[model samples]
Target: MAEETITLEVTRYRPREDREPRAQAFTVPYRKDWVVLDALNHIKDRVDGTLTYRWSCRMGVCGSCGMMVNGVPKLTCAAFLRDYLPGPIRVEPLAYFPVIRDLVVDIEDFMGKLRRVMPWIIRRTEQPLTAGEYRQTPAQLEAYKQFSMCINCMLCYAACPVYGLSPLFIGPAAIALGYRYNLDSRDEGYHLRQPILAEAVGVWQCTFVGECSAVCPKGVDPAAAIQRSKVAGAKDWFLSILLPRGGRS
Candidate 1:
């Protein structure tokens, strides 16, 4: 009996050779346990040595293998070929980003946005060594735990049309992470982060598309975080007007 096979329609782009991305098809052995990443590995190892992409920790933890699979942003490491079987699977570099090569999009913009959000625990003052370590209870940990699961895969960005149109927007992952730090019990940086979050290009640009949450692999509801941040910012703005001198109520 002939071996079963699956077809993969992969986008190919070479800066030096090609003017733009083009689809190239390849057929590989069909395995129920194989993922889209596995098929890509087969292509790289056996078929095409020049193919370019990014992947590490093939377990979906690194979040480096994000791609457009069947027109949806997904981590190729977790996208089982069986789920897309019955024919060819369309794979391309993530949308709304510059493709450096086949299946690899430049992420410098996301890195800049992430840095701008300052997704870290910030303290207004440091206590002496005599002061014990800052500890968090289960409930406190639970407050920001879900948002902290973000691996910065940028799948949320690919799913977000607002980001696609306006690269200046701070974006979902960054806001979600900033909100995560704000919810941290040990963090005293909400005041410092408010300027960025309250900016016109920040959370207000979302337009409630909701696709960011729908495609999140780690269940990080960035849309909710953005909306909540907007509410908080608005309340802060109102309080400042009433109290004046940028006072907190």
Candidate 2:
């Protein structure tokens, strides 16, 4: 009997060689256990050495394998071949971002937004080492635990229409991460991050489309985070007016 095979229609682009991106298909032996990343690896290793894409820790933790799998943002490592059986799979770089090569999108914009949010525990002053570690109850840890699961995979950014329309939007993951830090029991940087989150391009730009949460592989609900941030921003604004001397901190 002839071996079963699957077709993968992958995007190809060489900035210096190709004027625009184009699709190139390759046939590979089909295996039920193989993933989309596995197919790409087979093509690169055996069929065509020129095929290029990014993937690491094929277990889906690194978030580097994110791509547009048949028009939806997904981690190729987790996208199984058996799901789309007996035909071609269209794979491309994540949408709403500049493609550096074939399936690699430039993430500098996302990184900059994350940096602006200050996604870290910020203390007013560092306690001396002898003071012992700052502790939190399980409930306190649970407050921001889900938001902390982001691996920077950026699938949220790709699925977000607000980001696609407005490049200046601070975006889902960044805002979610900011909200995470704000919710941390040991953090004292709410005042510092509030201005950024309350800005015109911050959480307000989200529009509550909810796609960011739908495509999250880690089940991180960034849409909820953004909305919560909006609420927090509004409360901060009201407190600033009601108590001029002692607003939210």
Residue pairs with colliding backbones in model 2 are none
lDDT of 2 by residue, 117-153 (tens): 9999999999999999999999999999999999999
Candidate 1 segments whose C-alpha is farther than 4 A from its true place: none
Q: Where is the poorest 10-residue window by lDDT in model 2?
A: 240-249
Per-residue alpha-carbon lDDT of model 1 for 1-249, expressed as tens digits?
Answer: 999999999999999989978999999999999999999999999999988899999997999999999999999999999999686999999999999989999999999988988898898788777999999999999999999999999999999999999999999999999999999999999888877987999988989999999999999999999999999998888888888676763
> What is residue 243's positional error in candidate 1, in angstroms?
1.3
Q: List the residue pairs that clash in candidate 1.
A: none
Segments in model 2 whose C-alpha atoms lie over 4 Å from true places? none
